[model samples]
Target chain A: MSSMVHHFPILLVAIPILAAAITMMLRSKPKLQTGFSVLASFSLVPISFILLMNVWNSGIQVYEVGEWGKYGIMLVADLLSAGMVMLSSFVSFLSLIYSLDYIEKRSLSTYHPLFNLLIAGLHGSFLTGDIFNLFVFFEVLLLSSCGLVVALEKDGVTKSTDKLEATFKYLVLNMLGSILMLIAVASLYATTGTLNMADISVKLSAMQAAGNLPWHVFAIGLLFIVVFGNKAAIFPLHYWLPDVHPTAPSPISAMLSGVLIKVGVYGMLRVFFFIFTDLHDMFQPIIIVLALLTIGIGAVSAVAQTDVKRLLAYSSVSQIGYVFLGIGFGSLGAIAASLVYLVNHAIAKSLLFLTSGGIIHHAGTRDMNKMGGMVNSSPFMATAFLIGSMSIAGLPPMGGFISKFTLFDAGIMGQYYKEITIALLFAIFSLFYMFRAWLLMFWGEKRDVKRYGEYSEHSISPMIYMPIMILALMVLILGVYAEPLLSIAQATAVQILNPQAYIDTVLTRVVR
Target chain B: MNNTLLSLTISILFGIGTFLILRRDIVKVIIGLSILSHAVNLLIVSVGAFSGKDVPIITHDEVASTNTIFIDSLINGIFAPMLNGTNPTQYVDPLVQALVLTAIVISLATTAMIIILAYRIHEEYGTTDIHKLKRLWG
Candidate 1:
């Protein structure tokens, strides 16, 4: 392989950092800054696609910083992280483009830099092999996201004070989680004598095989779960999510809900599959039970929500449950199912949030009860919203159907009969709430909707439509022809299962 | 004995931190996070303890002769280190120290950010009680 290929994994993160710095220098020129940031985001697509393709064949690629030995910080772009990078790049690019016409130029310039930084952070969290580096990236992403949420402080709805308060709560709780994770990593390292993931995995297995497992090792793993669960918005630990996600700008919401929470999922899998593979029996069952409860509670809560963004926020909670359900099962089929669901949810849910942004911008309210027959006024927005709804609802001929079906099938295949049964039942409930929000916003007789000064006549910008169209088209294509995507997910799942492949590739000296 | 003492102190701090987090005050929360960090640092440093030896550090050839979990091959052949093939005094678990250092930095950064956020909340809302900030929910 060419030495240049090694630069791709870290560059996925570095490019945006470079872009943000250049953006700061160009800050006096807002339009230019916005243009530069947009160009930078679009550039990530090719880089991400290339990395994903490399990992698809190579299994995993480790890029150690400074050409340092195995003891130093390493960035491993395994199949799983590579795929997430690809999805995140596509979503962030589209979201940036969408923001062009939707937000004021003054706000867009500030927002776009932070947006690029947030994506960079997401890529960092995914690629970093050192556990502590993950914490650093998590903070970077969280702080930038909070900055964007307060960037445009509306007077009443999502006001500055409320945003600050909510962000503070989110920060405090997330910091608590991060502290726990650090403690866990410290404890694990003390016992295992290695910070490299592959090295730790080998040592952990030997400890277990020796029948001398340290009690603190178990505590460390549990602590990691709590931290990751908080990020993933798992039910018991998800109190901050509903408050925080919708409090941000709609484009930011798409990124947060679309990409950020999934980092939690990624971390959980990394710890479980990569670092503590021997502790499978202790952890997997707990995850499965939690998945069941998370799904039930998230769906039940979603049905009762009245605010459009809040409802989508709650729906995200329910949708993430599907991801956990597949992960918990731990079979080849289940992992594949979960992988498919992850991509599908990122697109469908983000589209829903973006459409909600359009609705709120035009209608001047987030309350679904206040919205009426917007379909008559904004057919394109309504149609896009319906397409998003259908995909998320798992209707036939949509990406949601394929992913959800795979998850359910995998659960059954793995003898998780109850899980599959419950998932199917809640799948219907998800459709109900999605359509309920849809009807209240778009289907009723036109009422006295508070129009927001005719929307700059820029609602249909190519940047705005491109993300929606690309995602919508992906949904349709994946629904009809899921073979290629599933194959990619399948290869990734196999890599995740036999995490030795990843550990050996990164920690051991490869024979030339 | 040192290991036992270290474990006890870490556990105690963790307990106190947990209790503080349950309280309503924001200041208490910051203290709770700090206490938790120190507790982790203690737990990490204690994991490398071995009996009848000072902390693992190389001073000279004489110091390198100390019995531990990672004695050199030649010394092990002569003395036969007690812990089976594992020498009891050759290597310090450098991993824990590295983790502890990173944890300290991360917690410090977060603590600083938390204080700023608290000050901002105090400025904007005139109070820090989360229960009173009821604009978004419901």
Candidate 2:
């Protein structure tokens, strides 16, 4: 068991790659592929949980690929990485099952493989100790998601032209971001002569202590905002997300909203908290300003959106702003609040997306104006979406409330009064937009059947509803009993803010 | 002088790439991406830690013998091989080269994906102009 624990860090990434390859081979047998993909994705939940437990029990777990120690690529699993892996795996497992019924049969052949590969990329990006390896994993994530976005769906409701255009924008912007990342990474390597993140942290701090740290290193640190900001879809960089997330098939939308954008937050946390701790004072104001802008833009744009999916996509942008706000606060409580906010948003947003899929399917349109009084027809979807929207609106008795409360509490505790006030103002925007969207869809007069066509009376498959219900239940449970999640998030925050544990583990490894 | 020239060249390539990407033509944008990648790759190589002419590779025989004179004289007076066995700074840094190789492969794969996507976009819209492709505006 102990030996197996050592291998968990690599296996967390490897299992998905191996499964993707196998799933590709079973393309002729999609049923078998579906079963296999479900099995593989669900298996990740336990593996990630066990890995998290191991990290909690022991210190950081470092696995050097090819036994090159710090000289080679290393996979490091700390509390935060393991916790994220656990969250991603759980969300992915549910999304995969939802995809079984949600994705068209024709697309399943490539969808399963691409989805697994994306998971592999996500795990790899989170666990890798080498910054360059993180870049590689980012590419893996980018290309696979590009493929998934253009994949064909059953009803062909989402036009291929739109998918292609959104993907084009996504690719072009992200590719530019990648180039910036490469330049920053290359420059950092030139300055530090090391690629291992832990080694860089140690070397950089030592350099700072000696008063010889160069100015460009700070530029490189800022460059990360472009790299990860592009990923997380913050403020100016968030244009592609509202286009792309809404255009993808629903399960893919769930995965994108649930886990993919969080990758940016993870990168920001890892790089800022661990690698660039000395520059916190310099970075704090910049991050705070960006966070406020992100919240404002996402909320205002969401109000103007008529497309249900696009509205949710814009809301994702707003929620990510709150997470960044917590991060910019740079306190133990603030980081924990951010983590809690992140987890709740992951659950609620994915639930909302999956339910929106069902709603769109039933209504035969993506426009909220075309969808009215859905509770008269698909009550289950209406209820599920209500739960999700209420949670997202930060209403009481939902997980979103707890997260928002904690975030605002910590913001006050840290005494960022003006920023928190502005954030709270935008939080009202969140409430207004979310409730407006909900009221527009579920409470109004049923759209004249003669014009928009009658809502589909056909019952939704359990495969679709089951995942939504599960996530909805989780949102309720998390809100009602927030202790365990909060504690874990607190622990993860402690691990991130203090990098000594990570540095010691990665640097002291025996070279094979 | 060489460093300044290289930096100037990289900046020019980056400027050109940015300009092309801003154009309406999809093919031009892809060309811009390729050019940008080349610039980045060059930037990595130029940042290599050593100015020595010798390759980074060291033979097992060289490791076993530890004859400083034999190894030091192989390269010219630009940089001498440090035989102290404590640091290997004399040889060119191999890590950046390896990273550049990975970056190249990644950019290659991305370029291919983007090109195919462009072709598909062109097929779908019957035009490569990005302005005409705005069906998803808020």
Off by over 4 Å in 2: B58-89
What digit string (tens of lDDT, one per residue) describes model 1 on residues A334-425? 88889899998998888888878777776777777777778878887888888888888999888899998888888877788877888888
Please tell me the TM-score of chain B in candidate 1 relative to the true structure's chain B. Answer: 0.70
> Over the stretch B14-52, how does candidate 2's per-residue lDDT look in tens digits?
999989988989999999999999999999988886576
Q: What is the interface RMSD of each candidate, in Å?
A: 4.7, 4.6
Worst 10 residues of 2 chain A by lDDT: A448-457
lDDT by residue for model 1 over B35-88, one digit each (tens)? 887887777677644443445454566434543322213222322113335445
What is the model-wide C-alpha lDDT for candidate 2? 0.89
Per-prediction TM-score: 0.90, 0.96
Q: How do the residues A184-226 of candidate 2 rate in per-residue lDDT, one tens digit apiece?
A: 8888887776788987787778778778789998899899998
DockQ of each: 0.35, 0.45
Badly placed stretches (over 4 Å) of model 1 are A104-109, A153-157, A448-459, A510-512, B1-5, B47-98
